[model samples]
Every structure is written in structure tokens, then in C-alpha cells.
Target: MIIRKAIKEDVPSIVSMIADDKLGALRENYQNPLPLRYYEAFKRINEDPNQELVVITNAKEDVIGTLQLSFIQYLTYQGGIRAQIEAVRVHKTYRSKGIGQKLFEWAINRAMERKAHGVQLTTDKKRPEALNFYEKLGFKASHEGMKLHL
Candidate 1:
């Protein structure tokens, strides 16, 4: 398997992975197949040197996993940057195979390379396994995250 930056063509695979049943209510919002704007946002991310999109591909070179890392520069941190991880998803067939860890490890290294104060992310309350995984990765629930349906 190869881990690399995501390209425009990978969007469909990314959308499929995230739309999997395992995603639960989170997918309820972005329920449709990926919209074109996603690639547009990806283009913006690609243009930003401080942001990154990572994907894991199988031997067949099919995009099967993806994650996002966005850098936040803060004044309180005093030159220490922050990285927020988002949209981590692996193909259904590839679940429980350490792909998630590999993706997160890549994000961590990228955050460190960017001199981030820390990396952060939020998973839904329904994703108990993911919460456990993040805890194992040394992340704590520092604040309560909420959302309002529009």
C-alpha cells in the first residue's frame, strides 16, 4: 500500500468511504455522492502549504483511505501552530487493518513537521471505537463539541 497526498480523482473514493454505514449520522449530512465543491475545497487545500490531504492506496493503486490536516496559527500559542485532523475514513474492506493508524501517524508526523503545538479532531459520540482509538493516540476530550441542524 502507498500513502500519498490526495488528487482530484480520489474524491469519489473518499466520498464512498465516508458514506459507508460505519460513518453513521455524520454521513447523514453529506449524504449525496461527493459534490464538485469538495474538489474545489481540495484545490484550496492543495494550494495552502500549511494544509494537507493524505490518502492510502492499495497495491492496485485504488484510493481506499483519506484524512485531512489543517494548520492553525495562534497568538496564544506563541508561534506554536495547531493542526486539526478531519475526515479520516478507510474502505469497508480495509477496516481493522491498521490503515487508520497509518493515516493518523502520517498526520502526526506532518503536524510535527509544521511545528504544531498539537493536533486535534472530533468524532461523533456514536463512534465509540474511534473515540477509544483517539484516546489511545493520546488525545483527550478537552471540550464538548456540538452541532446544530440547519
Candidate 2:
């Protein structure tokens, strides 16, 4: 398997993976000829130097997993930069096959390479298995994460 920066054409596959689960089904608007908004968001992310949207592909180059890493500069931690990982998903068929672990390993290493002081990610409380998987990768529930939806 190979992990690489996602291109525009990979949007649909990525969205499919994102929408495969119960929670994602409620929030993601994935459909045939997928909504224009996904592509628009991809363009914005792709253009940002601090954002990375990556896809993990199999030997045939089929997209099987994806994640987005955003580097944030902050005044805390001695003006350090932290990498925030989001939207991680592996195709249903690819789960339990070590793909997700590989994805995280790559992202964490990339964050270090980019000089990030730490890497962080938030998994929905509803996803206990996901939380467990993250814990295995050495992440801690260091702080309570809250969100305000507009």
C-alpha cells in the first residue's frame, strides 16, 4: 500500500469511505456525482500549505483510506506547532487489516518531519473502537474536547 497526497479525482472515493459508517452517514452528503461542496473543500485544503489531505491506496492504486492533517501555530507550548488529525477513515473492506495503523504511523512521522511539537486527533465519543485504536498508538485523552456548531 502507498499513501500519497489526495487529488481532486480521489474525492468521491474518500467521501465514500467517510460515509460508510453510521455516524458518518448522518453527516456526510455522499452520492453519485457527489456534491460540489466536497470538491470545493478539497480545493481549499489542497491550496493550503499547512493542510494535508492524504489517501492510502492499494497495489492497484485504489483509494482505501484517508485522513486530513492540519498544522496549527499556537502561542502555547513555547510557540510550537501542533498537527491536528481529522477525518480518518478506512474502507470497510480494509478495516482490521492494519491499514488504519499504517495511516496513523505515516501521519505522525510526517508531523515530526514538519517540526510539529505534537500530533493530536479527536474521535467521536460514540466510536469506542476508534478511541481504543488511537490509544494503542499512544494518544491520551489529555483534554476534554468540546465543539460549537454553527
Candidate 3:
């Protein structure tokens, strides 16, 4: 599989992957005509120098996996820069083929190249399998994550 920066044309496939799971089905809009919000968000991400929207393609060049990485600069950790991985998803047909592992590896390497202090990601607490998958990749459950929906 080839990993590369996602182009605007890949947005629809990425959104479909995001809406493929049960949890995602509940939160993602998968209407017959997808919402414009997705395209708008893609525009913002594409314009951000610190953000990357990536896709994994097979030999046929079909996009089967995706994730977004954001490099953050903060005062803590001695003003270190860190890469945050988010929106990671692989097409259901492509799961269990080590694509996710390869994706994470790519992200980690990219982070190192950017001089990031570390790479971090959060999986839904309900996804025990995902939690285990992350642990195998050397991530630790070092802190509690909280959020407030607007």
C-alpha cells in the first residue's frame, strides 16, 4: 500500500470510511447527498501547514485507509511540538491486513521528521479492541481525556 497526502478528491472516500462503523454511523452524516460541511472541513485542513490529511492506497490506487495528523506547538513539555493523530479509519474490507499498523508507523515517522516531541492519539473508550491495538503500537494510557460538546 502507498501512503500519501490526501487530495480534495479523496474526501468522499475518507468520509465513507468514517461512516462505515456502528459508532460512526450514529455520528457521521451519510445522507444520499453528503453534507457540505465535510468539504468545508477538508478545505481548512488542506490549507493548514501544520495539518496533514493522509490516505493509504492499494496497488490499484484505491483509497482504503485514512487519518489526519496535526502538529501542535505548546508551552508545556518545554515548548515542544507534538503530532496529534485523529480521524483514523480503514475501510472495513481492509481491516486486519496490518494497514492500521502501517498507518501509525508512517505517522510516527512523519512526526519524528517534523521534530515533534511525541505522537499521540485518542480512541473512543468504548472501543476496547482499538485500545488494545494502540497499546501494541507502544502507546500508553497516561492520562484521562475529557471533552465538552458545544
Candidate 4:
């Protein structure tokens, strides 16, 4: 398997993997021809210097997993940059093969390479297994994250 920056063609596979989960099923709209908004968002992400959208592909170059990493500039922590990881998903058939770990490792390394002060991510409370997996990766429950949907 190879990890690389996602291309336009990989969007469908990425969305499919994302929507395969119970939580994601409610929020993601995956169809034969995906909605225009997804592509528009992809375009914005691709054009942004601080955004890195990546995909893991199999030997045949089929996208099987995906994640988005963002470098956020903050005045706190002495103006340090923080890496925020989001949208991490592996194709249902590809789970338990360490693909997710590999994706996190790559993202964390990239964040370090960019001189980020820390890496952060939020997982839904409903996913106990995901929380455990993240804890195993050395991430602590250091902060309580709250969100508001606009």
C-alpha cells in the first residue's frame, strides 16, 4: 500500500470509506455521482497551503483509506502551529490491517516536520473503540472539545 496526496479521482473512494461507518452514514452523502459541494470543498482544501488531504491506495492504486490534516496557526502556545487531524477513515474491508495507524503515523510525522507544537483530533463519544485506539497511540484526553453546528 502507498500513501499519497489525494487526487480528484480519489474523492469518491474517500467519501465511500467515510460513509461506510455508522456515525458517518448520517453525515456523509455518498452516491453514484457525489454532490457538487464535496468537490467544491475538495478544491478549496487542495488549493490551501496548510491543508493536506491524503489517501492510502492499494497495489492497484485504488484508494482504500483517507485523512485530512490541517496546520493551524495560533497565538497561544507562543504562536506555535498545531496540526489538526480529521476525516480519518479506512475502507471497511481494509480495517484491522493497521492502515489507520499508518495514516496517523504519516500525519504526525508530517506535523513534526512542519514544526507543529502538537497534533490534535476529536472523536465522537459514541465511538468507544476509536477512543481506545487513539489512547493506544499516545494521545491523551487533554482537553474537552465542544462544537456548534451552524
Candidate 5:
């Protein structure tokens, strides 16, 4: 599999991967005349120097996995930059094939190259398998995550 930064044309495929699962089916919309918000967000992420929306394509150049990495600079860690991994999705057919591990490895290497203090990610508590996968990748459950939806 070849991993690379995602382009606008990959949006539909990415959306389909996201909506393939139960959780995503509840929150993602994959319909004709796809929402403008997705495209707009993609454009913004593409334009941001600190954010990367990446896709992993198969031998046929079909997208099979994707994830986002964000570099955040903050004062708390002595003005260190932290790499945040999010929106990870591997097509159901491609799961259990080590694609997710490859994706995380790439992200971690990218963070190291950028001099990030550390790498972090959050998995839904309901996803025990995901949590275990992350732990196997050397991530720790160091803190609680909270959010307020608008």
C-alpha cells in the first residue's frame, strides 16, 4: 500500500470508508450531492500547514485507508509541538491486514521528523479492539478526554 496526502478527488472514497461502519453510519453522510461541509473542511485541512489528511491506496491506486495528523504547538510542554492522530479508518475488507499499524508508523515517523514532543490519539471507549490496537502501538491512556458538542 502507498500512503500519501489526500487530494480533493479522494473525498468520496474517504467518506465511504468512514460510513462503512456502524458508528460512522450514524454520523457520516454518504449520499448524492454530498454535503458541502465535507469538501469545505477538506479544503481547510489541505490548506493548513499543521494538518495532514492522508490516504493509503492499494496496488490499484484505490484508497483503502485514511487518517489525519495535526501538529499542535502549545506552551504547557515548554512550547512543544504535539502530533494528534484522528479520523483513522481502514476499509472493512482491508482490516486485520496490518494497514492500521502501517498508518500509525507513518504518522509517528512524521511527528518525529517534525520534532513533535509526542504523538497522541483518542479512540472511542466503546471500541475495545481499537483501544487494544493503540496500546499495542505503545500508546498509553494517560488522560481523560472530554468534549462539548454544539
Candidate 6:
């Protein structure tokens, strides 16, 4: 498996993979032509010094997994940086083969390289496996992060 930074060429596959996940209902809103908003976000994240998108591919160059990482500057912790992991998913066929773990480890190490004070991620409470995975990766629960869905 090869892990590399994402490029525009990877967008179609990435979008398709996310759309295939039942948990991706939230993303379906941006499907079809995959609006400018999505493009802008991909560009912003890929171009920003503190953000990144990684694609895991087979030796054949077919993408099998992907993740988005954001390195944010936080003033609450004396301006220390925090890396946020988002949209992490592995193809169903690739699950249970240590691909997700490897991708996560790579993200965490990259965050450290950027001088981030910590790395964090959020998963649905219903996803017990995701919760367990994060715990195994040494992440402790911080607090309840409430969201206002309007």
C-alpha cells in the first residue's frame, strides 16, 4: 500500500467512496457534479500549510482509503496547534487488514511533524468499533462536543 497526498485527480474516486458509505448521508448533499464548495474545500485543505488529505492506494495505483487532516492553531491552549482528523474511511474490502491503522499512524506522525500539540477525531457514538480504534490509538475522551444541527 502506498500513502500519498491527495490531488485533484483523486477527487472522483474519493467522492465515490464517501458516497458509498451509508454513514455518508451527510455527504450525499454534495454529490452529482460535486459542487464548487467541495472543490474549494479540497483546494483549500490541500493548499493550506496546516491541512492535508491523504490517499492510500494499491501498488496498482487504485485508491483504497482516504483521510483528511487539519492542523489548526488554537489560542485556548496558548496558541498551540491541534490536528483534527476527518473523513477517514477505508474501503469495505480493505477493512480488518490493518490499512486504517496504518493510515491513522501516518496522519498522527505527520501532525507531529507540523508541531501539533495533539491529534483528535470524532466518531458517531453508534460506531463502537471506531471508538475502540481511537482508544487503541491512545486517544482519550476529551469532552462532549455538542453541535447545533439547524
The Cα error of candidate 2 at residue 77, in Å, is 1.6
Please count the clashing residue pairs in each candidate, in the order shown: 0, 0, 0, 0, 0, 0
Candidate 6 per-residue lDDT, tens place, 24-139, comes to 85545546677667777788888887778999998889899999998888897788999999888887888888999999999999988988898888888867988999898898
| Candidate 1: segments with Cα more than 4 A from true spot | 22-34, 148-150
RMSD of each: 2.5, 0.6, 0.9, 0.7, 0.9, 1.9
Query: Between candidates 5 and 6, which one is better according to lDDT?
Result: 5
Q: Which candidate wins on TM-score? A: 2
Error in Å for residue 72 of model 2: 0.2
lDDT of 1: 0.84
Best candidate according to lDDT: 2
Off by over 4 Å in 3: none
For model 4, residues 1-150, the per-residue Cα lDDT tens digits are: 999999888888988988898988999999989998889999999999999999998999889889999999999999999999999998888899999999999999999999999999999999999899899999999999999999
lDDT of 3 at 38: 89
- Kindly list the per-residue Cα lDDT of model 3 for residues 12-92, writing each as its tens digit: 899999998889999999775668998899999999999999999999999999999999999998999999999999988
Once superposed on the true structure, which residue ranges of model 6 sit more than 4 Å away at CA? 29-36
Would you list the C-alpha lDDT of every candidate in the order shown? 0.84, 0.96, 0.93, 0.94, 0.95, 0.85
lDDT of 5 by residue, 18-96 (tens): 8888889999999877799999999999999999999999999999999999999999888999999999999999999
Q: Model 2 over residues 1-150: C-alpha lDDT tens digits? A: 999999999999999999999999999999999999999999999999999999999999999999999999999999999999999999998899999999999999999999999999998999999999999999999999999989
lDDT of 5 at 140: 95
Q: Candidates sorted by TM-score, descending order?
A: 2, 4, 5, 3, 6, 1
Q: What is the TM-score of each candidate against the true structure?
A: 0.86, 0.98, 0.96, 0.98, 0.97, 0.89
* Pairs with backbone N, CA or C atoms under 3 Å apart (clashes), candidate 6: none
Q: What's the residue-level lDDT of 80 in candidate 5? A: 96
What is the model-wide C-alpha lDDT for candidate 4?
0.94
How accurate locally is residue 38 in candidate 1, as Cα lDDT from 0 to 100?
Answer: 73
